[model samples]
Target: MRIWVVLAASALGLAGASRVAAQRALGKLLFFEPALSVNGKRSCASCHRPEKAFTDHRGTPRALRFAGNLRRNSPTILNAAGQTSFFHDGRASSLDAVIEAVLTSPDEFGSSYAQAAQRLGSSAEYRQLFRRAFAAPVAANTINAALVAYLRAQTATASPYDRARAGGPALPATPAAGAALFAGAGGCAGCHGGPQFRDGQRHEVAAGQWVKTPTLRNVAVTMPYRADGGAATLAAVLTDGYHRPLPPRPLTAPEVEQLTAFLEALTDTTSADHRAPAALPRMRDLPGRAVGGQY
Candidate 1:
């Protein structure tokens, strides 16, 4: 009788794990599916290219969507699951809400939840996948939940800096020096504190422009810095892009280089390479235009 009970419990656990795996697979498929868009050309992966550290660097600051250019730079979705707020302005409260906004926004997918469901439902493959993932009919909520599940799995915290911090191996001298400065005289820890390297608070870096503090987990690759993508380089971000009055003491060129080295040490190449989705062809040939906005 005990043996039977144990077998039953093991079967249930396996079923649950299988269900979760199915959901994550479905979510990844949907995230890369352009069928959710009006033109059936643009997918979430289009702008958030996996090769580019989940950010688009082809355009100026903001990525060009199906409708028009985004108002701000496309922030990396890596480590996004830890963020409490979404978007530069913290507009959407949750990932589900953000997905809904993107689907309905004219400048984005340009489709309502119903429209997206109908479009995806037309595909028998998608229907089967959705059924396996949610055990329910293909709907907006299920779709959003699946996408969020996949996104939540997108983490990149195994960088050299992370290893060194964990006492695995000592970081090289340059990066070690830079890391010290980051926590000490640089005063970067005042804002970019914690394991994620962000205070998770919004502050007005400039007049009337309130922006959420971004995580510097992979700052080395997530370029076109700042909320507006105004600062083209890390150096630029450390200089003129920050809130005026500076962080007490100013950073010298050498200090900036050292900081850059420390930031580079934070790159998680394994995550970047492993998480990239298959390449998708461009939907439209419209040229991207530079837009003016504040981060």
Candidate 2:
């Protein structure tokens, strides 16, 4: 009887694991699905390309149906799970709210939840996946939950700096020296603190404008820097002298190099799941290279 009970518990644990995996897989397909958009050409991956550190490599992603272009740069969604607020200006209080805004924004997905549901629900493949993942019909809540799961799974925290912090191994020479400067002279830890390297609060960068401090997990690839993408390079971000609570003093040339090395050492995207599904559920016009959409 005890053996049977142990086996039952093991089976339940396996079932739970299977459900989590199914949810992440379903979310990946939905993430790459363009049919949810009014134009049927854009998806979350369009702006957050996996190979590009989950950023579109644009200062600001171009707005389709809306007037001109998006105001802020396309911040990387990698390591973005626990941010206190979403978006550059901290407009959305939750990740689900961010998804809702983007889905309805005239410039973005440019559609409504009802339309998106209708399109996705038409796909038998999507329906099956949703059922397996959530044991429920595809709808706003389930879709959002799957998306949240996938987005939260994109964390990349195995960097050399993190390893050093964990007492596993020390960082390389240059990065080690730079780490000292980061906390001391650089004063970066004042805002970019904690394990995620962010304080999750908006800070005044310009006279009247304040933007949330973004994580430095993959800052090497998610340039041009700043909320507006004004700084073209990491070096520029250090020398621009635009941010408030500036470093104790101007960083010298060697110090700048040291800080840059330290920042680069924070990158650890090797573990992120960058695979795209073989095909979307009911996507009609799958492009030759449509994994991340046209953009």
Candidate 3:
């Protein structure tokens, strides 16, 4: 009886792992499925390219059906799993709300959750994947849940900076100097604090307008900084763009270089799966976009 009990427990654990894998796979397909968009031309991966540290590398991405452009930069989804708020404006209270806004926004997927559910349900492969993962039919809630699961799984792995802090090799001199300025005179830590490097609160940059503090985990790669993507470079982000006034003692050119080095040292790509799947779900009239998106 003891042996049987142990075997049953092991079997259950294996089954749970299998289910998680299935769900993750399904979520990946959904993430890259352009057919979910009304025009069938874009996917979530379109704006959040994996190789570019999960950013589109665009200042502001074009909107659905080419209907103008989004107002803010496409922030990296890396290490975004546990952020308190979503988007530059912090309009969405939760990730679920963020997904829903994207689904229905005319500048985004340009489709409703009901429409997406119906479209996905028509694909037998998607239906099977959904059932296997959720033990339910293809629907709005399951689709959202799968995406949330996948997004939440994208946590950050240690970087050079993190390793150094863990008693590994120290950061090189330039980055080490930058780290000092960041935590000290530069006052970057005032807002970009915590393990994720954000305060999870909005602050007034100039006057009445407020913007959410963004995570600095991969800030090196997700360039064209600020909520509006106005700052073209790291130096520019420090000197101009959207930010509160710097310390009364301005950062000198050398200090700027050091700070940039420190910011770059924060980049770590190992935590998330960046590769695009070879194909997406089999849906009629919906061909796969490029690994990310064409735009």
* RMSD (CA, Å), each prediction: 7.7, 5.8, 5.7
What digit string (tens of lDDT, one per residue) describes model 2 on residues 1-295? 1332343234336568787788778888878888767877788988888888888888888786545788889999888888779998898888788888998998888899888887778778888887777766777877787787688888899887888889988888888888898887788898888888899999888789989999988898788888887788888988886732388678888888888999999888787987777777653343333554555
- Runs of candidate 1 exceeding 4 Å displacement: 1-14, 58-68, 241-244, 272-295
**What is the per-residue lDDT of model 1 for residues 99-147, given as tens digits with 9 covering 90 to 100?**
8888887877777878778776766767787777766677877788778
Choose the strongest candidate by TM-score. 3
**Model 1: lowest-lDDT 10 consecutive positions:** 286-295
Better of 2 and 3 by TM-score: 3
Best-first order by TM-score:
3, 2, 1
Query: Which residue pairs show collisions in model 3?
Result: none
lDDT of each: 0.73, 0.80, 0.81
Q: What are the runs in model 2 whose C-alpha is more than 4 Å off? A: 1-14, 65-67, 283-289
TM-score of 1: 0.85
lDDT at residue 221 of model 3 (Cα atoms): 86
Clashes of each: 0, 0, 0
Per-residue accuracy of model 3 over 8-116 as CA lDDT, tens digit each: 2343365687867777778888888877788778889988888888887888988877778899899998888777789997888877788889988888998987888
Give TM per candidate.
0.85, 0.90, 0.91
Worst window of 10 by summed lDDT in candidate 2: 1-10
> What's the best-to-worst order under lDDT?
3, 2, 1
For model 3, give the 10-residue run with minimal summed lDDT: 1-10
